[model samples]
Target: MKLYQRLHPGVNLGPTDPENHEEAEEKIFGFWIFLMSDLVLFSVLFATYAAMSIQGVALGPSPKDIFDLSPVFLETMVLLASSFTFGLAILELKYRKNQGRLALWLTLTGLLGALFVGLELNDYRILLTEHGAAPQTSGFLSAYYLLTGTHALHVSVAIIWLIVLAVQLATLGPVGPVKLRLMRLALFWHMLDIIWIGIFTFVYLYGVVL
Candidate 1:
């Protein structure tokens, strides 16, 4: 047995039907391509945010004026925890094959994700209503909303997807198709965590410091 397979015995599921394995590999490869495209999209948004951050804040609230670090920090931790729970869910699905435990982890992950989105929207409300940092106010605020809003949108969709997958798991158990879908969801959820880290560092940290 391979080292990883030995370490996590049930995960590898060695010597599957050849045709099914090929199809699964193809779908995963396609998902990787989609993720690469998403990376490009985020790269453009980050560059725009950087360029605009300095240009139009003189007449309005700066990032420092509107960013509440406490909430942002809390949401970041929440998202990180969700990712960890999702990892546990995968372990349960692959190793233990325990339906109830997997569903519990998935539910917890979805709740954490929803909380992150809620906190983010609250941040937006504070900026727009209290500090007058609406997208129409300045380039900085516009770019800020666009970047963060796009990420928030992604998380919202992910939460919906999680719900659907949980339903599937409950109905179908850990069959091949469900397992494949869960693998894709895992990649996606973890990807959002990474993107959030970048946002916290680049937008929030740099915005406050510089």
Candidate 2:
């Protein structure tokens, strides 16, 4: 049991026995598996978007016509900043063990994420109202909405998760389960940032250039 525990320092042995340690490992591993499944789902969405985007504009405005780079740039900056803030919160929790600092950083991250979502929705609304770029109007618009809307949905869920995590940190401090949950959330936020980069480069930048 000691050997197993030594091999896996992340598993909290606390007052519980080896069984609890095994359970903790299982939980973390299970979460990773779930993340893998999510990756597959996102991959499918990306592929579909790519396939459909070739015919995206249809009779509506082309990507270069209605796709404004300014708001997309802002949204990208805010989300990337949120990811950095989340890293700071992780640092505070892991090293400083300061619940107050962690909570503040996390709150900032959540606010930034919320700002990104708001900007995205506003951008979509502008496309619909000012540009008449509704999803039903063209194949390109449909793919555009699906791809970006899916990402926006993930960001929304992450914001809610951040709120719940902040409450947990306040109530429980940096306990084992809380730390694990925070780690998972960090992974999620970072993944979203990476995915957004792909979107920015492939979907937006390429759309504009070609």
Q: Which candidate ranks first by lDDT, i.e. highest?
A: 1
The digit string of per-residue lDDT tens for model 2 on 12-124 reads: 44334343455556666777788788888888888887877785556777788887788899999999999999999877766677777888999899999999999999998
Residues 1-210 of candidate 1 have per-residue lDDT tens digits of 543344223434334423344455667778879988998999999999988888866577788777777889999999999999999998887668778898899999999999999999999888877887889888888899999999999999999999998888888878888887887888889999999999999999988887
**Angstrom error at residue 171, model 1:** 1.4
Can you tell me which runs of candidate 1 are displaced by over 4 Å? 1-22
Cα TM-score of candidate 1: 0.90
TM-scores of the candidates in the order shown:
0.90, 0.86
lDDT of 2 at 77: 98
Worst 10 residues of 1 by lDDT: 4-13
Model 2, residue 139: C-alpha shift (Å): 1.5
lDDT of 1: 0.84
lDDT of 1 at 186: 85
